[model samples]
Target: MSSIIYTLPEGFTTGTDDTLIYFYTNDRPSEKNKVVFTKNMLCLLQNGIKVVHTANGKEIVTNEEVLMLASGSILMSEQTVANKYEAILIFFGNKTLSDFCAKRRLSFNEKSPSKSIFKVPQDSFLKNFCLSLKLLKEQGNSEMNEVKIQEVLNYISTTSPDIFNRFVGQALAGKSDIKIKQVVGLNLHNGLTTEELAFLCDMSVSTFKRHFAALYNMPPQKYFLQQKMDQAKLLLSLQKRPSEIYAELGYENLSAFSNEFKKHFGLSPKQFQTENGPGEKAFGLPEQQFFKDVPATL
Candidate 1:
């Protein structure tokens, strides 16, 4: 079997079964999308599992339900089939998790603080998440209640949402020079105003925007709001209070935050919490609201 290795830039844990993650394919066809799956599968990436499919004499990732496989390719997998191909991973076993970690080739120790990275063997994550997903199989969730699922999601969010926010923040903030070897990069604050940030970065306002744009798509001011919103979505998912989130975001007035959030996202921040709080799985809200701000060139 051909194995793919990834030097993960962020740490991740999934909150629920409805969430699917993509590491390398940002802004590509295979970028994040809502997927359909029959059997339960949680694709965790400790060792990078490359899903290849063959089409027109080449490997291609076919468009299928949750798992898409390219119809053509030659490889050593007992599970291989035509017209469909996908990667499976299992990390429950100690050896399995170790094998995945062996391939994390990036040196994250270059920074002041080291980020703790962990992964489930690919199949392990897939399976565990599926087992947690009672809704996917249409299984009666009369037994699965909010409090229990929230606890699982809370654990996943503790490790991942912050990491994802860090990635999006670092990219949006134009911090290419900073060696971001881990997901949450030392818990650095990303919400900085252009005026406030220029002073912090030791650059003049004009110079800051110019340098910042090179690394991030837009100027820092616009990007900061978007980044905060993304983080807020993740927070809301765990059933955090809107008033607290507003305070956590350092907004003096909750009403102002709510209005802008509603204008930008098509739903008030409070509405988002109600609609998608724990089990709605509405992952597309932020993208729809803030994608317009990304530089056209990006």
Candidate 2:
């Protein structure tokens, strides 16, 4: 299924750097919605179930738990039990987490796995904390939002040390190279724009381009086009028709894909296919075998 891209905080009615406390309520249930978190987030589900699908697996959160998600992409589905879904979403940046750790002198095990999502069980204290945030949002006391978020971080660190440490480690481990790799690998076949990819990686477009070049030795647009052309050639050699593979390669239509294929290989896809015939093995080996030797970073 085609996925919708959303960058939180930017999509909200707040500035990018501001820590936003948002009361989210919906009357409808949604399934498999793709969400790319540009900032670290804490989601306290009050009256619904949230299933987050990540590379590792799916995590389910309900009223009994809070979800702490690192900046990344996930397929999320929300279900309401009483014809309404509700949650409190808190968005903060890496700097906020770093400053919080510094102020508290918090130390975590370096060997802890840097997980993308942490499910924190909701207790009486957390339920009360959620209530306080909802009240603050209703009272329009946005000035204290950051302070309140920090207070919750402090509470988590004190009460659930392991989860807190893993969350912190995940935030700390989100380096430029790692984040770029993750975003690109997940979206390689999706044909997302540069700005969208940058947003997903939580970086500015220029910064994303710079890091992308360092890793791939070419600009992102060029690298992506080359990869698509290479894959198209392999598919055509396997007897897949141009019309059948264009959409799968992220092209909108046959004409656009054909034009690009010609530009890259100096021959239209049909002409190339006619000359090479089926099962010709374009890269000297089967497609699966050829991809096995490719670098993991790509």
Candidate 3:
């Protein structure tokens, strides 16, 4: 998927499955990876800490914390020393949520987090439930794995109504309000298609473009390109080679990347590097102050 930042191992459920479990362990610490949550996700950081940055504020999730990320894009910065970093992630979509509510005859009408991300208050049962999920996964028992998902849901519904509502409440509320600022700010560095971005914002492509232009006074594509160019200039200033940064900017080939850079700054990538070198000002539009003032909450 366009949103995948890391290729998780095979024990996790497929997208089509009603429930999913993700187990991640890395012996070598990796550079921070940005990812877009394609579905509503529940994450339990079992070991090591994770720092998540969004258009809003940054959140630090530790083993004692449980994080709930709405269906949206987010920049995840992972950190670990010599020790292995591990986490258990669970994903449930609208369909699975609908089935759960219908079967339990429960109500989920509360308003959800105004921002796309939030930390859920820890529950003792929830922690234990996560441990059981790990056990099921280790056994490779697909059937038991699904049951563990339901068990956690049932626990939340019965013992912790507030947490349950916060977890799936907004998702059950149906489509969210499409705020131009939130959508654009969150996806500035993201490599999502216009159509995918529209879907996340709960708007048709035409509507998204119309609203975007009205808000920013320029077409979305133009704004996106400008942002990318600004980032490229910053990377060049840091002495990063064009080859290393091109793919990160979503370009497929060096030739195309150079052409775009030349068009934007009147210099090819190599020529710009040769003149500006490292630690020198690379030519491009000055950083936009608007990004600095992005709202601290979504």
Candidate 4:
């Protein structure tokens, strides 16, 4: 079952369990920045982009988006983001999602919520699903995917992806004491230059260097390059947008993407994105890969 929670920064006021949390970051602009295209993320648009490098980023997705974490080895984020948002939300973790995928014939689209925003087309099942979240919350096992929860989640899979993503977001938000560290890659995944990293996070270069070593035992540039390369490989395998992959990983030019790709795997970004095998560009997707912690009870 899914229960909704609201996340707020310190000093923010809120209401009951049914209260909706505000998500927009004040500094995040609605401006359309340069878009990048690479291998997984090809058809989405992201908001709140602050480019630390060149003005023109990759042209990966086509619309402004709210990205969601879907799958993979990423365990950094506290919540998974999905593109193509909608009004309703549906979520079932680890077991529920896995079991349903195993038993049903469904394919999660690579598109963001901005694309189609799920469509339920029916309601008989919707009523039951809402009840499930409410009941779970009331019983305080809102995190668990009991047989009842699974039934509701799976039944609602036919509803809309938006509803599913919302449920997941809401459930995660509801938890008390969610640590900011739960977000995996704030500065970790995409390593930055000492100065660049310091600037983005609002710290001095000296402080940034010290913290970088304390966290990863290396300089920011090295960490950034490694993540850039790692993402390059995943972009190839997941078929994510080549250009966006470059920007997300901190590259400023196709040359940078190409050079890094070669340094890591002897292949250029273009060649890798075109490759149709694992460790190469296979499918493109948005939202940085991160493992949103799912309650063990679920």
Candidate 5:
């Protein structure tokens, strides 16, 4: 499937660098769009059906529910209602959250389940709060936008303590290594650039490169290429024709796939398949067997 990368805050022209509040609207339907959220986000959907796909599972959101998302990569699809889709997005970083909690002396339930995303039922207070944000946006009062975001967080803390604790816990958890693994594993076949991957992992390109090398024992590009080549070989061993599997492996065409396969394995896909018949071992063991031992980080 084709994918689009959306890097928020930088993608929009509203609000400050660290924290932003914007009224988001769309006139059409969008599906499977990859969003790299650099900051924690609170989304109040006024109209539309939003399907969010993450490592945990799929979540369907609507006007009756609000979505609280931590900084990460997620596949999102939105279907418009009445020819329009609308939501108010508030983006803030961990520092903003920490400051809000410290200023209020808010204590989280450490035992609460940490989740990267949350869907909470919208209440009257939240609805009114969203209305206020829309008014402020129209008034060009950027200063109050941050306060309004904090106000929503405070409201959630008091009204929905369980969800607030879980959301906050995940936001401040700081599990960088686990996050790197998840981001890399999920987007391996999605044709994303290293810069985009770094953005998804919420790290600078330099930091991501360093961490990637430490974890994978190789450069990111080389590791990705190796993995893709391995997959191509596995597909070939399964009796799948080169033309049938090249697109599945993200190659632009059969020629590109064959060229890379030859460079990596010293044989074209057809030549490899002929040399090692279907269902026979190619790498001294069954290709399926190799996948069984693949580590979670992969």
Candidate 6:
């Protein structure tokens, strides 16, 4: 299980147990910031709207809606249409969910969805359930917090079996041996070291490399860098500023980003943007020779 605890800056209040709950409100609107979720996150939006960009697509979340983000990274930008941004959030680690499943005797036979973000369909039962948890917090019943967590899991299992199965599958996926495709695609935008990624995949460095090489027919490092470059080109064609996108591409500094771009595309980001028009392909998706051999999850 991941032990990374996300501690927000000052003015953010947190409640904790096996799961971490954050009550967040920001006076100022947020700029597009890169956020890495080390654990799966479920948020109930009480006010304002949040727009998130993942590798797959964009999601717009608003009040009365629930959003689930898989354990990975995303570029998030927020806007407050009327009031300040406020939300009740739970960050659930795999170990916690696995324990919950063990206690409930719940198991899933299906695979999780490949898309990183899921907008949970809301119902009256879910709304009342969330409200009851809110009341539990107001009443200072800290001892019942775990009960509330179980209630949420139980509600999901009964009302939305597909989502419940997906959650279960995700919980188990972290512990078992997953495919090379799942690990690489999910972490393409992540900046973890090779050793760190190997650890996350439950493999030794040597084993991870051997499997990765067998699948991609290339070194993992080189293959990932090429993928990042290709994604950068796509983002640039959409007129995103290099400064705004460099960090999301996992580059630490602008100079290095510029150097890498020039090396790959034969022009600086700005120059390329100025010279080449939009809708041109930088390259076509890194050969994709083994994609047919790999089936996407769900």
What lDDT would each prediction earn against the true structure?
A: 0.40, 0.82, 0.69, 0.40, 0.81, 0.69
Return the top candidate by lDDT: 2
| Runs in model 2 lying further than 4 Å from the true structure | 111-114, 174-298
Off by over 4 Å in 5: 14-16, 109-114, 175-298
> lDDT by residue for model 3 over 108-191, one digit each (tens)?
555655555667645676778777877877888667766776776676567668666665665655533324455666677677
Number of the predicted model whose TM-score against the real structure is largest = 2
Candidate 5 residue-wise lDDT at 16: 54
Give residue 51's lDDT in candidate 5 (0 to 100): 93
Give me the runs in candidate 6 sitting further than 4 Å from their true place: 1-17, 109-112, 177-298
Q: How much is 130 displaced in model 2, in angstroms?
A: 1.4
| Tens-digit lDDT track of model 5 for 169-240 | 777675355456667777777778899999997899999999889767999999889889878877787778
The sequence of per-residue lDDT tens digits that candidate 1 reaches over residues 207-240 is 7677667645677667667766776776776677
Indicate the TM-score of model 5. 0.56
Arranged by TM-score, best first = 2, 5, 6, 3, 1, 4
Minimum summed lDDT over a 10-residue window in model 1 is located at 63-72
- Output the worst ten-in-a-row residue range by lDDT, candidate 3: 1-10
The digit string of per-residue lDDT tens for model 4 on 1-298 reads 1132222212233322211222222332223322221101001122323211122222222123222222211111111134222122232233334334334533343233332112233354544544555566567673453565456446555545556654333323322111111211454444445576556646677865675565456765666666556656655566566766666666676676778678777777667656555443223433233213211210
Q: What clash count does candidate 1 reach?
A: 18
Candidate 3 error regions (>4 Å): 1-15, 30-32, 110-112, 121-124, 175-298
